[model samples]
Target: MIIGLHVQVTVNRPLGSTHPEHHTIQYPLNYGYVAGVIGGDGEPQDAYVLDVATPVRQQTGYVVAIIHRRDDNETKWVVAPKFRFVTEAEVRKATNFQEKYFQDDIWLL
Candidate 1:
């Protein structure tokens, strides 16, 4: 996904929420799926909402980057405020809770 594209996200996994299968892992940022969009995983396309101050159930933001996983087919979109920006290092830190298990790279718009 290109940056600056406004998109809505439904937060299936909010910040601090434990992973559905792996209870030991916690989501550091709002994590969810794009409505009505299917990804390589055969589910709704997943996205990570960043630059938000507090936890939320759902929101809309612009895409800043894509987290393409080498080990898995599913890729994740990084959403943030239009005026806000997230560095590559910050992106890694924010997603490392679960992403640590995958081989991935960040692609900015």
Candidate 2:
């Protein structure tokens, strides 16, 4: 229920990096998860970090939107700085580097 609040995330996959296991997949942005907040995957909820242009180990930002996957059980949260409102189009473009394989919608808060 942190749909509109700022939360802490541990960046397991930083920007310009590849998945530890799926080496073919590359991360264009800071992709992480909220500790202790379990998702449908039975793990820490995964998130897509936005507005941050550089790689980081962790970050704190507002939960601006939820990327609900129609083809998968996983739902990713969209986090961005509180200073600006991120457009849905921007989210789609930023996450497309990886999310292109799945069907999703941006649920704005």
Candidate 3:
């Protein structure tokens, strides 16, 4: 339902950063959540930032897709810069770092 909405995502897990608990898992892209918005997990809405290579503190873009973890209850939003278009293949490749461990689907706009 949030697809096509523009939002600012606070990048808590920047690119190249290691997972807080799982050191073996690293972030290939910036990932964070939207402030004040609650998601299915009862926390800030989590998002995976796309279209950026370097580690950033935050990102402002449109919600391009959602990574729905079939086994898990959480859904990660995919955000991309203004005017930028993201494909399903790109989302898979960018989020494979962690999503690979779970059964998921790309919910596109």
C-alpha local distance difference test of each model: 0.86, 0.88, 0.90
lDDT digits (tens) for residues 22-104 of candidate 3: 99999989999999889888999999988889999988999989899899879999998874667889889989989999999
TM-score of 3: 0.93
Model 2 C-alpha lDDT per residue in residues 1-109, reported as the tens digit of each score: 7677778889999998998888999998999999988998898999989888999999998898889999998999989867356788988998888888899888875
Find the candidate with the highest TM-score and give its number: 3
What does the lDDT come to for candidate 3?
0.90
lDDT, residue 105, model 3: 84
**Per-residue alpha-carbon lDDT of model 1 for 15-107, expressed as tens digits?**
878989999998888999888889989999899988876789898988888899999999999998673667889889988888889999898
CA RMSD of each candidate after superposition: 1.4, 1.4, 1.1
- Listed per model in order, the count of residue pairs whose N, CA or C atoms clash below 3 Å is 0, 0, 0
C-alpha lDDT (0 to 100) for residue 70 of candidate 2? 93
Pick by TM-score: 1 or 3, better one: 3
Using all chains and alpha carbons, the TM-scores for the candidates as numbered come to 0.91, 0.91, 0.93
